[model samples]
Target: MEGNMNYFEIFKDVSVVFFIAIPPWLALRKYLKNYLNRAFLTIFFITYIIATLLTQNVFPFILVVLCFYFAIKMKDNFEVLYYLRPIKEKKTEIILYCLFFRFIIYIINVFYASLLEYVGIKVKAQDIYEIFLNAGWIKVIFLFAMTVVFAPIVEEFTFRHILYRGLSKKIGKQLSAALTSFLFALIHYNLAGFVSFFGIGIYNCYLYEKYGYRAAVVNHFIFNFISVLLILLIKIFNIPTVMT
Candidate 1:
């Protein structure tokens, strides 16, 4: 399996219509006090569709930021910040817990990648890392900012905070977790790693429900950071993979 496949193509697929459609729908529903009225909902949906089509590249990012802002503002409890408030006694234990679970997910991802190859799919393990590695320093900085920081804030707030919270109201926590995880995996648009992505999505949801939103965000950041670091080492040293 060659590992130099174009990952951006994953984002450009027709299925992207669904992923791109979700933010505005969910975000508007959060702010719309009259969301329960079918007529208003229909009208607003149409308006949002038109607006999204007409907007520029930065609009979606701006909408994500606004959603992040409102998600925090509307929460009755400040769980986003308060969840990780340190307890001197449990601090070490918390660190261990994150490390342990992150390690578990890493194993799961590697196994999942192998499983994909076993099933005849070629897995490009370094697609995203190569983007980081090959880009200029300034572009790499922006990529890091967009992925590790802005993306986590936007995605965690959207999927874990807003969507998960909204769904939990209508469904069981277990079902909500699974559904949210499924959607999260779907949006990534990478069939080869779908199972692995779903696993991490569920893990993040567990952290969100058990600890708080901040825990999910931190876990996401740590996962991406470790992934990039590992890939950077691999690229620099030309480490052999199963594909190689």
Candidate 2:
């Protein structure tokens, strides 16, 4: 039964990847003909694959930095940095909204874990969390940088600025946001956290549409910063609990 369940989980993940990723690619194939769009997508997927295959926690940080460097070199072609400007107004509002969403994500995580436990299945800590728990202080700081700074930049540029924008042009914005959110959640490959990620993805899309890409990026940074703080607290206190 355990083996069967593993197979089922694998099947579900593959199905999600196919349904969420392939259809959008097909729809946006022509749109991606633009050099900047194609390049950004390529960078995003390559980094994603490398980050997945390489178990070392620091690789993600390195890959994202490389991605950002390439993006900077191409700034003249796409004005990429314009979207990365810090949010100058309504800082408090953005922070509050992020905190609210973080709370909702926590509730969703707890409910999912409880449901899995009720079914006699133990919930596993997310891979990044495990990395944090096991790593030395120096490595943990690198992981924190990846989480709080670099990840948000690369992920927002790819998902919100590239994917969401391209998909919006092909489909309507509403459907585009939904599809982008679905792909964002699947890319993380955390079944137990899918709903929470999806919810945040939707919120990020909304921020992008309403306030431009900077808002989305800031939202992601705040969300991750809070998560990293909690993880640091856990490590400092030697908490026995695992977070999904």
Candidate 3:
């Protein structure tokens, strides 16, 4: 019975990603190169309605829509898709910088967790981690794709590339980085993770400024890959540990 329930939960999660997430994402990517047209808008609204009906939590969809909206506005001036360019050089430097940022993020998480615990607030694993805790191997692999691959690309493009560059034009780099970092932390909807996310966001903004779009994406990818690897190890070894 428990096994059956786990399968059902996995099916539901996969359905949400397939039905609620992928179509709109693909549409946005397709239409992003060209000017905003009727076909793209139609598909977006259709997906929005379907997503809303499928899940009460429509915040993430709305957030993505907003990012794309801004992205379209900035398309004429900026190469909005420049983040997708291949990073052909500085492979070793990017990896080293990613490791440095990952260490800093870990420290931020530890400090935040300690502060919360001091105030009698327990820091628990994020929802994704909880899903991993109960998920079978198939579900774990699916989640690995979502977390380590899909999420880093979408998020780095949205937050570090589009949002950061747009804001930098109006505000100074420092202020823009701070605001973007706050928004990035806010979107996670996890209070326990806010500080860590904010720290990483700031680091990503620094990378975007110093190294350019692909470097920031690489850093984000490395960050998420480590977390997924840790989860895999825990599940394989049946190790007891707190994710947060």
Candidate 4:
């Protein structure tokens, strides 16, 4: 077990991980010129970790500014925003398909939750929940922005569009999806909801492959939105099972 540490301690550990990983990535930039940008990634990680620690009180504002900054910078290479543009065709079909996928994923999550409970694997909510649960309105708003807005955009780009796309080029899509899904679950740093997150990750990858990155983003938003709603409902209804 690890001892308790302050934010800077954790940031130090995170920096080390990036430091160790960055060199090989930098070396491969020549080969991966089109796919990867070492500078953007380096800056992104630095901003992400520091912004997370420093801007708790002004998270939404900082994130909004950063989002626009990235959008401008990524205009040409904006694979992240490409799918988010307005759709010309199959709009209705795509939405209906996404709604259906959400339902399917929900059912899978239920079963996956049950399985985790059966095996006695603890299912922990993501840490951000505790952070914003009883905080003031600003914090609540920040949580919403983080979960429903920024998380969907950043995570979908990183896990689905970027990582899965790159990996699928080497391995087949199936293997890539599996690997990316596991990484997605792993990054959330929760053991209990691992299966649930993995299921959603694969589902998002499927949406990205079949429909578009935008579809995956919408699906991701819906998932997180629903989770937020559930948390709200639990608090409102005082659900005993989850309360303890």
Highest-lDDT candidate: 3
Sort all candidates by TM-score, best to worst.
3, 4, 2, 1
Runs of candidate 4 exceeding 4 Å displacement:
1-49, 52-85, 241-244
Clashing pairs in 2: none
Q: Write model 1 residue lDDT over 58-90, tens digit each, in one string.
A: 344566655555555666256544543334464
Give the per-residue lDDT digits (tens) of candidate 2, residues 120-224: 987665678878878999999878886887667666766787788878889989999999899888777676777777887899999887676778878888878
Alpha-carbon RMSD to native, per candidate: 6.3, 6.4, 7.4, 6.3
| Model 3 spans > 4 angstroms off | 1-41, 48-85
Compare the candidates by TM-score and give the number of the best one: 3
Q: List TM-scores for all candidates, in order.
A: 0.68, 0.68, 0.73, 0.69
Give RMSD (Å) of candidate 1 vs. truth: 6.3
Q: Tell me the TM-score of model 1.
A: 0.68
- What are the lDDT scores of the predictions, listed in order? 0.65, 0.70, 0.72, 0.64
- Backbone N/Cα/C clashes per model: 0, 0, 0, 2
Error of 2 at 243 (Å): 2.5
Deviation from native of the Cα of residue 78 in model 1, angstroms: 8.5
TM-score of 4: 0.69
lDDT of 3 by residue, 14-59 (tens): 6455434554455455555465677976776567656644542343
